[model samples]
Target: MSHNGVQTESQRTALVVVAHHRTDSLTAHIGRRTVAQLEAAGYRIDFLDLHAEGFDPRMNIEDQPDWGNREKPYSDEAQAHMQRVLAADIVVAVFPVYWMSVPAVLKGWIDRVWNYGFAYGRSKPRLAGKRMLWLGLGGIAGDDAALPAMQEALDGQLNAGIAYYCGFSHSMVGLLPDAEERPQRLDAAGNLNIGDAISGIERDDHYVEFDRKAAGFVEEFLAADRVPA
Candidate 1:
C-alpha cells in the first residue's frame, strides 16, 4: 500500500519473464523497454531472461506431475523457479509469437515450474491474487486479415488456458505488430520505390507510435478492478 492508502509498487513486485534466444533480439528490446516503463511507474521488477540464465526447456522425470502427491518436490531448478512464482504479486511475459502462441521455452517453463500442485490440482490456488500480462511481438501488420484471429487465439491461450488455470485474478495479452515493415513498396507502375519507413527519422516516428500502443496495454492492465474470490 502507498502513503495515500492506495496500493503502490513498493508493496508489489512483478516477476517479468523474457523468452528469446538472443539478448539483442527485438523481443528482448521490447522487454527491456517494458521493464523501464514499469520501474518508472514505481514497480519493483524481478527480470528473468530465460536464455541468458540457461534454463532447460526439456522436461525430465523429476519435473513430471504427480497427481497423488501435491507435496512432491520438483527438480532443483524447477523448485527454485517455483519459489520466484510464489514470491511475486504480478507476472509478466515478453516473447515473440511462434505458431500463434508462446515459444517452446516459455511453455516449458510453465510445464515445469507451474507444476500440478503449485499452479493447479488444488482446492485453493497458491497464485490466487496475482495478475499477469503477456506481451507478444509479431511481424504481422495491424491491418492484416489474420490479425483478429491471431489476437483471439493468443487471448484464449494466455488468459483462459494458462492464467485462469493458474488462478490469476486478471490476465491480458498485448500484441505488437508491424515488426517487419519495409520502406520499399510497389509503386503505381508496379515497381518498387523507397517508402517513408526507409528514412531514419520516419522510422523513429513510427516506432514512437508503436511504443505508445504498447504502453496503452499496460496502463489498462494497471487500472483493472481487483475482484477477490
Candidate 2:
C-alpha cells in the first residue's frame, strides 16, 4: 500500500457534475472554483458539464426502470457517463436549486446512469464505497427564514433518497445561499420593492467569500477520507 515509503490509494479522481445552462452564471462559477481546488489538491478532475455536453434530461422508453434486469445496456451516452462515474473516487454535483431538487438534466443523468444493477438493485451495489457532495447554490437570501426548510428538503431528497439508496459510503449536501441578489425583494405586505444592483465593490467581496466557502466544503470532503476511527 506504500510507494516510496508513502502510502497511496488509487489515483484520486472526481466527477464534478455541473447543471447550469449558462457558462456565465454563478452556478458555473462555483463549479469552476470547485474544480480548481480539487485539482490543486491532487485530484484528476472529470468535469461533467451536463448542459454543455448536451446530456438529455428526458427519460425515453429505453431508460425506464427494469426490476428484472439491472444490466440492460442503456443508451451509449448513459453507459459512457456511467463509466466516467465509475472511474472517480468521489462525485460532486454543483447546481442551482430547482424546486428544492436537482435540475432536470442532472436528475435525468442520474435516472439513466445510476439505473438498476449499475448503482443499485444487486446484492452488492456497484457504487457502495464512493463519497459524494451535493453542492447547490440558490438565489434565496442566506438569512431567509425559509432557508432551513429548504435545506432539510434537499437533504432528504439528494442525500437520503439518492446517495444513500445508491450505497455511497458518505454524502454531504452543502447549500450556498444568497448566490443571487435579485433585482427585487418583496416587502412585508408582499409588495415588490425594486432593489438596487450590487455595487462593484460589494459584488467582488461577495464572490470572494463565495469562492472561499466553496473551497472549504471541498477541503472538508478531502479530509474526511483521511480521518481514522
Candidate 3:
C-alpha cells in the first residue's frame, strides 16, 4: 500500500472542513490558506464549507429508534459530506471559537456526520487510523487568561470527547484575536497585540508556514505507521 515509497494515495488525502458563517474574516483566509498548503505538499485536499453547502446540523426524529433494524440514510448532500470525511487520511477542522467551543455549524456537522455506525461502534472503528487537526480562531487575546481555558476545552471536551471517542489522534492550533491582528514581534513581557501585528505579516509566507507545520504532522504520522491510539 505504498506510493513512491510513502503512504498510498488513499493515505495522503486530507479533509479540510471549514465551519465559518462569515467568509470575509481572516479565519476564512487562514482556512483557505491551509488547503493551499496541503495541496502544494502533494496531499489531495477536500474542502467543505458547511454553511455554503447548506448542511443541516440538527438531528431529526428519524435518527433515534427503539430496537429495530436501522438504516443510516443520508441525503445526497450529507452523503457527499460524509464521503469526504471517510476518504481522508487526515481531517482538519477550521472555525472560530464561540463561547469556548466550536461554532454551531461545525458542531452540528460533527453531530450529523459522525454517526454511530459510520464513525464508531464496531469492533474496528471506521475512522480509526485517521488523524485530526483543529484550527481555531478566537476573538480574545492568546494569553494565559484567554487561552488556557479554551485549550482545556479543546483537549478535554472536543479532542477527548469527540475525536478520541471516534478513535482518532488529535492536535490543535489556535490563531487568536485574529491572524491579522497579532504583532510581528512579541514584546519583552510576551504580550502580543496581534491585530496590530497582522499588518506587517506576509500573508503568503504565513500560510506556507502554517501548511508546512500541518503537512509535517501528517508526514510524521505516516512515517511512524501506527494506527490511531
Candidate 4:
C-alpha cells in the first residue's frame, strides 16, 4: 500500500514504549531521542508512554490468562495493547532498570499485553517476525566492575527469557548506565558507593555522552532490521 508516494511497508511502523512517571527523566529523554531517530529513518512512530497514558500495570481478573485455554478472552485494555503490538514491525521499550530488570510497568506490560494466547502459546506465534529493542536506563556508574555482569543478566532475562519465548525474530537490550547525576558504584566489599552530584559543564557533558551512546544504540537497532534479503 502507498500513501503520499510512500510505500507503507517500506516506511514500517515502530511502537516505542516509554515507562516513566516523569517526562523530564533520563529514561524519557532517551525514549524521545529514540523516537526522533526512528522517525528520521522513515518509520511511522506509535509512541506509548505507559504512565502518561494511564496504563495500569497491575494485572486484574479480566486480563488474567487461563492456563488451559490458549484462546482465552482478555480485557478490553489488554486487547487494545495487543492491537498496537500487532500493528508494529518493531517495538522499542525505554524504561529504567530496577533491580537489574525492567521496571514494574514494563514487566506488567509483558504480563498483560504479551499474554499466552496472543504473544505465546501457539505453534505459529503471532509475534514471530517482530523485532524488539529494550533500552534500559541504569543508575550504576559505567565504570562499575559489576556492569558487565549486570548487562549479561539483563540480556538473559529480556532477550533469552522473554522476547525469544514469545517468538520475536530479534531483540536487543541497550543498557545505558551512569544515568544518575551522582556517581554510583559498588566497592570491593560489595557496599554501595555514592559520589557527590555533578553540575556545571560536567553535568552537561555527562548527559551529552549518554544521549550520544543511546542514539548509537538506536542506530544499530535500525541497521539490524535492514538486513539484506
* Local accuracy of candidate 3 as per-residue lDDT tens digits, 52-148: 7788888765443222433466556556666888888888888888877888888878876787667766668888878787777666653445567
Candidate 4: residue 136 lDDT (0-100):
90
lDDT (tens digit, per residue) of candidate 1 on 17-62: 9999999887888888888777766677788999889999898999
Best by the lDDT measure: 4
Candidate 2: residue 17 lDDT (0-100) = 90
Give a tens-digit lDDT track for model 4, residues 1-229.
1112254656788899999999999888888888888877888888899998899989999889898998998998999999999988999999999999988988999999999889999999999999999999999999999899889989999999999999999999999999999999999999998999999999999889999999999889888888964
Superposition TM-score, candidate 4 onto the true structure: 0.95
What C-alpha lDDT, on a 0 to 100 scale, does residue 219 get in candidate 3? 51
Ranking by lDDT: 4, 2, 1, 3
Clash totals in order: 0, 0, 6, 0
Report per-prediction Cα RMSD to one decimal: 5.2, 4.1, 5.9, 2.6
Positional deviation of residue 150's Cα in model 4 after best superposition, in angstroms: 1.0
Assess every candidate by TM-score: 0.86, 0.90, 0.72, 0.95
CA shift at 56, candidate 2, in angstroms? 0.6
Compose the digit string of candidate 2's lDDT tens values, residues 107-154: 999998898878889778789899999999977677666679889999
Cα deviation at 170, candidate 2, in Å, is 0.5
Candidate 1 residue 61 Cα shift, in angstroms, is: 0.6
Q: Please give the CA lDDT of all the candidate structures.
A: 0.82, 0.83, 0.67, 0.90
Model 1, residue 72: C-alpha shift (Å) = 0.8
C-alpha lDDT of candidate 4 relative to the true structure: 0.90
- For TM-score, candidate 2 versus 4, the one ahead is 4
Give stretches of model 2 more than 4 Å off.
1-9, 183-194
Off by over 4 Å in 3: 1-11, 64-71, 171-229
